[model samples]
Target chain A: MDLEFSPEDIAFRDEVRKFLEESYPESLRGKASRDEYEREDFLLWQKTLYERGWGAPAWPKEYGGTGWTSIQRFIFQEECARAETIPIPPFGMNMLAPVLLAFGSEEQKQEYLPPIIKGETFWCQGYSEPGSGSDLASLKTTAVRDGDEYVINGQKTWTTLGHFADWIFVLCRTDPSAKKLQEGISFILVNMKTPGVEVKPIITLDGSHEVNETWFTDVRVPVANRVGEENKGWTYAKYLLLHERSGIAGVGRSKRAVERLKEIAATEVSHGEPIIHDPTFARKIAELEVDLTALEYTELRTLAAEAQGKGPGPESSLLKVKGTEIQQRLTELTLEAVGNYAAPYFRGFPKDGDNAYPIGPGYAHMAAPLYANMRKTSIYGGSNEIQRNIIAKAVLGL
Target chain B: MDFNFTSEQDQLRDMVARLMREQYDFDTRRKIASSEPGWRPEMWSQFAELGLLAAPFTEEEGGFGGPIETMIMMEEFGKGLVIEPFLQTAVIAFLQGIIGGEKIFGFAYAEPQGRYNLNDLATTAKKDGDGYVLNGHKAVAHGGPMATHFIVTARTGGDQRDDKGVGVFIVAKDAKGVTTRDYPTVDGQRASEVYFENVSVGADALIGSGDDLALVEKVVDEAIAALCAEAVGCMKVLNEATVDYSKQRKQFGVPIASFQVLQHRMVDMFMAAEQAVSMAYMVTLKLGEDDVERAKAASAAKVQTGKAGKLISQDAVQIHGGMGMTDELNVGHYFKRLTMIGQQFGDVDFHLKRYAKLSAG
Candidate 1:
């Protein structure tokens, strides 16, 4: 019921703010704000956070975590959002680290957890196949166990950041004739550099190479890379998805978008007044703030529940549904605010590219691309429709 | 910040929702809207008994609820599509009126020439020895016929479109030299074009003297937030109803829900409803803040709700196909109400401009 931060919380917040101001890279901040960053830029920030012992706030305390309370974690996230720092890739940290901690053998944990925390290794998910997207259990990808190795052959589509990955954690079928579909699957980790493994780029509507289709043809994976028991991939995959969906709310980022929207509106003029003053445009910003505020509350509520030792529950589905849509809307509104500058296609963005001169205000360059990229939010981390079905069954008892 | 609703607020919402469910069902609402007053007196009394009428005012103003409580109640009322003048009678009038008790109230502010500007008033009330002589025309005064009292905005000293010198006066509905031309609005609620021809009122009738511009703006903003909440409720119903209909109605020998295109459209409609709900909650929470920020938040909310409402209602009807246009179906009524809600206070375009102006220092 109380929103006021305690004196200790305020002190902690100030400490975190001081650290960010002092340590966050200046050059990295510029690239991050514009959302034009290389893998090295992301890892640089991750290394700094890791060095400060704040690498994985959600990780168990034993796994190099800060062991901060949920509220403190929320505060740190809020600060990161306000700072608009390029996000550390989620595939390695939030998604795989938790599964490794829960299901990995001692050797697996010792070998994998350290590099992941230090940002030395990159990871990508190999769950979705061409025909097995929403219905992931129907995946035809198989890995036959032969002696001490499993020969894998399959294609995984929509492999986000697969080109940047050193390794991939896949859901592969080890038993094709099991009584149930979900029971035949096994979780296996594979090195991206293995023989017969290929990563083909997927240039999306935004003309970015952020995703890839990874193909595995008779790639041999050691049995030691299997997580937990055979035929238990679905359980691990579901667990990883829960971790993924919990943070998909993206409250902090959306708040930043609102600030960005205000900045753009304050500068752009229409009929002699700043567009922000134009009731038509100002109203859109105001309405967005409202939706963002509600979403902020919903996220905080989820955090509060987590503070009480409760998992995200079905409400995470609600968050994913609303959060992604709001993100999409923010980008759409941003593109609208930028006017004709958001021409859906850019000849060259930076100074040295094909088109010599940048088109509009530096801020307007990313608006259209960001809008197109955000479409994946609703589709990925399990599509929003699947989340709705989850809500219907779990929350609504349908 | 903590976002959990207090148990009391949750209980209040539940109570209002239950009452709407049992007594204010769609059939009863249709009957009441088609009747003489165009709203139910019994329902108004019940709301009064439940303190719903006094929920938006402060404790100093003899009311129990704050802005948050008002938001909760309004959201429930919105869900039920309640035809009562809670916004006009309680939110605008009770707060602005010189005296308030059992009587229903209406706001006579928007002039024929003023458009959406509350300050653009050609209506003038010249002061006499103890009272004022009022002469003006007020267009689209919602809840006009049901209200026993009227809160009229008039220009006392400034030019027709000036922001200053505007006064709020309380005029009795039965007063002499007053005329009201009443008709049903598109949303099935009653409104009026009220006229004041040399109408006289005592000095005591001036609740806020000619310079209460901020007060007028705040009240209107609150009303706008409440209306946004109502739109969110209607959008919620429209989305669900459309989905249900799509699942049942077959095309190409399969239910329309089987089509991926229609499913994606439903998802879009659902997201719009969710975003509208979020924005409505946001604006309602901002209602009690400092004037500029409050106005800015209100306009932002109005814009979002208007957009989301339009998208959801129109998409709902389109998904439902031809039957969606019929009066027998509830989607058309929701669409009509949603359309009117957008035009209230200010439409999306107007609010966007207002937000831009207010945002600039």
Candidate 2:
């Protein structure tokens, strides 16, 4: 009944705090902005965790996981936020590894797990295509057998970190004639260095390069790279996404953000006083915090259930919905707090590559860009509308 | 009390709509946005040729009309997603163009710190003998790359954020010590980070008597009304696009528009666009009203436009799904424009507060 941490959990939390405080490289300290973190910076963090035997806390212990309870995993993510450490990209460890453990062959696990653990490889998910986004089952990227290899040909867009990745696990259509659009999809891993594969940046509204358009022109991949049986990638893909949705509540980040919002309020002036003095402005923050608290507990309850070996259920859809709404509100408030400073755009096709001087306070620098980019939070992984539909069908049985 | 446009205004709308529909397709707009000058001079000439740019002036000035004409023209521009600077050059900018009466201009009022406050300026028009020495930067000067000149706002008499201190003056784009770093915006329009370092301007460059915050505010309110019409136009296209997309995009073996939940969303979008339509008309007609009434109408209309624009744009993209995120699709561009429009003159929050204040009085 109590939400208090047990002695063992407190001790684990301390160990995590110490590990992050000491092991996190100073060179990459505050420089690890989201998606802007270079390959070396990410590798540095992963390698640090690897040395501590904490590379994959959520993995099965036999396969080099920390074997901690879900609560411990939650504590680790929170501590990382408190420490302001760089976020580990999820494509490899968080996403691919879960699917691989559940559905991959022995050879696939042996080959991929070690590199993922050691931070020797970068893997990106290739589930989305230009034609298929929310209707992911309609993806048209094809992979056909050509003797020992499969000739993969198609374009995948919104490929987050595709430029930095060493490998990609793509969902390719192996049998287009199958009755269902979801049918005949195969999960196949391909080396990024393979011939006929190309990567081009797709700059978002924020003018940042976090995603890319990856084109594969008859890229040849070994047939053995396929995970599980033929025409069964959809099941594996859904499994990976379910794992992602459970963690997407982003409780840790939003809590840190509420504090940031208060700080911004205290600093920004309104009517010759700090905007926090305004009852209406303060009330907005209070209301947002109240919503966050409810979402946080909902997430905590989910984690507690998962700790008891109850796999993340469809209720993760609720967390995704509320969590993203809170995330977007935080950005919106920050944009409001910055007053007129949100207009000074920092970079504009850097003439000599120096667009250094941003207008106004440092807080205002990322406000507009972050607000622009956070629109993707609701749209990606699965849109909130889709999550609602999932709740309607899966939870309410409508 | 009337919502109907005058016959002349109707003709103007039809002319602009036809012109835009023919020459300003999505592909054409994208090409213009990416071009060297960032906008077609010929388009500006065409606007001048058709007397569309002269909508701000009286008939004797060889112009057709005023606020209502602007409303009609900008609404059409919004539908076509016109990337040119008609709002800046015609509706909001000054008239003392030494180049020609037909010379194009960009309005450069936004400072690095001015958010939506026209008075919160760091750019200075320091009194230097018979002229002023201008120094400081303007952020997001839309149409900077295309304009032969710019109408800039600066502080002349009082401290920053003081109403009495703001001055509107015309500055040449290629004036000595004036530098423009140009680039395309998220909404497929070109804007610049324009800098002035000790650039000199003649006393005649002042638009009004200088240091007229009321004058600045009046222009801003007028611009707000015009922007609202544009937003209304944006929302209508977004709503139609979403509804059309829903009927065509099938999932689960049926068109998504058949879903009750989605149909309700489309209905909400339709209502928002329709409300925006009423507000656009209300604001345009009220531009002739007193300051409180005019400002209130502008803010009230803008608040609705901002809300409608957000809901419609976001839902438009949501309904269109992944195709909305791509550059190839016109939906994302509208989404971006509607987004930037969300905060252009005053954001939803700003207008909400402004409307409340005006209401209290």
Q: Which candidate is the best by lDDT?
A: 2
Per-candidate TM-score against the hidden true structure: 0.56, 0.90
Q: Clashes per prediction?
A: 16, 1
Q: What is the DockQ of candidate 1?
A: 0.02
Q: For candidate 2, lDDT tens digit of each residue in A1-398?
A: 99899999999999999888888889877663332578888888898899899999999998899988888899999988777788888999989999999999888999999999888999898988866777789998999999998999999988898999999999999999999987899999999999998999886656677789899999999999999988999999999999888888888878887888889889876544677877878889999999999998898899898888789888999999999999988988887787655654554434575535543566776776677677788888888888998999999999
lDDT of 2 at B30: 76
Q: Per-residue lDDT of A248-309 in model 1, one digit per residue for the tens?
A: 88898889888989998887654435778876577788888899889888888898999999
Candidate 1, after superposition: displacement of residue B262 in Å?
3.6
User: Quick one: how many clashes does candidate 2 have?
Assistant: 1
- List the candidate 1 regions with Cα displacement exceeding 4 Å: A347-358, B1-361
What is the per-residue lDDT of model 1 for residues B181-227, given as tens digits with 9 covering 90 to 100? 76555466777778999999999888777687778898899888888
Please give, for residues B116-193, the per-residue lDDT of candidate 2 as tens digits.
778888899999998999999997787777777898999898877788878889888888999987666656677778
Clash pairs for candidate 2: A340-B115
Best by TM-score: 2
Residue A162, candidate 2: Cα error in Å is 2.9
